[model samples]
Target chain A: DAGVTQSPTHLIKTRGQQVTLRCSPKSGHDTVSWYQQALGQGPQFIFQYYEEEERQRGNFPDRFSGHQFPNYSSELNVNALLLGDSALYLCASSFASQPGNEKLFFGSGTQLSVL
Target chain B: AQTVTQSQPEMSVQEAETVTLSCTYDTSESDYYLFWYKQPPSRQMILVIRQEAYKQQNATENRFSVNFQKAAKSFSLKISDSQLGDAAMYFCAYKGRYGNKLVFGAGTILRVKS
Candidate 1:
């Protein structure tokens, strides 16, 4: 079965520009979560989407938003990006039914370079 | 809020030897889950092992195992007979019983020298 897949493995943007990252959930999974991993740091939660709605979000600012399609694919949009936004954006997928027990399947992640 | 910490920034081990990575977490919830994820140079985060709070028995997967001390809020991963492929950044993660988000540690880089 196919695992989680993300688009544009790498991206480059300017401080005032916006970028969109796409993710396709693993087969048989519905819940999608986005994370940002800065250089040499662990990933920080961005937000989570289930049933086409954002169920929870992290401490990120409003500039970060996401959308989950009915098919379980998701997109992360960052507006007015800053240099600090230069990081690896990881997308993970898991089944919402077994939230606590299911293991999150992660994509290779898109490396965002903000100048 | 839940937080995970990995104090070791980097660790090295000879091939075929063993290495342990330490992790500690802070959480108010009684029931939660802990995980160890390995991110190689390819940047894909792969689950190494996991432990459920209520379970007394430690969790083990192949050559990887976890020492979970719920009372002390400590979780450590031990990799046996380390191989070159094991060289990567190992991250400690935590998840609450009610929430779906995972809190992660800064990560420890493991280097296996042949």
Candidate 2:
């Protein structure tokens, strides 16, 4: 079974530039969530998408937004990025809505560097 | 709001020895889940083990086990008979009963000396 997959394993952009990171959830999974992991830090929840609608969001600002396609793939978009936006963008997927199923299989993550 | 904390930034243990990584969380909800995820240099977040808050007997998976004190809001991971492959960054995560979003701690890096 293919696990969660993310695109553009690494990215570099200048301040004020916009970036969109993609994710394909694991087979048999329908929920997709995005996280940000700064260097030497743990992953922080950005938001979660279920049934093609955003279900929950974290403390992130409006500059961070995401979408889930009908096929269960997800895209995280950051507008007018700041240097602090530079971090590893992680994508995680779960099989169901069950609380126990949310251990979440994570992707290798897209490392975004804002210079 | 929920939060998870890992007090230790780094730890080391000799090969074949054992070590424990500590974690604590803050949540008002009565039911939730705790997880230990291992991220090696390859950067894949692999699930090491998990514990459900309602289970009082604790959760054990092979050499990896957790001490879950729900009343105290503390969950700790103990890895027995560690190996070189166990050298990695370990993270503790939390999720409330209703949603799928996870709250993660700062993470602890484990070094295994041969």
Candidate achieving the largest lDDT: 1
Candidate 1: stretches off by over 4 Å:
none
Candidate 1 structure quality by residue, lDDT tens digits, B1-114: 788999999999999999999999999999999999999999999999989999999999999999999999999999999999999999999999778899999999999999
Number of the top-ranking candidate, with DockQ as the measure: 1
Clashes by residue pair, model 2? none
Candidate 2, residue A34: the lDDT equals 93
Please state the error at residue B109 of candidate 1 in Å: 0.4
B73-105 per-residue lDDT for model 2 (tens digits): 999999999999999999999987676688899
Model 2 residue A4 CA deviation (Å) reads 0.8
Q: Residue B60 of candidate 2: its Cα lDDT? A: 93
For candidate 1, give the lDDT of residue B32: 92
> What are the lDDT figures for the candidates, one per model?
0.96, 0.92
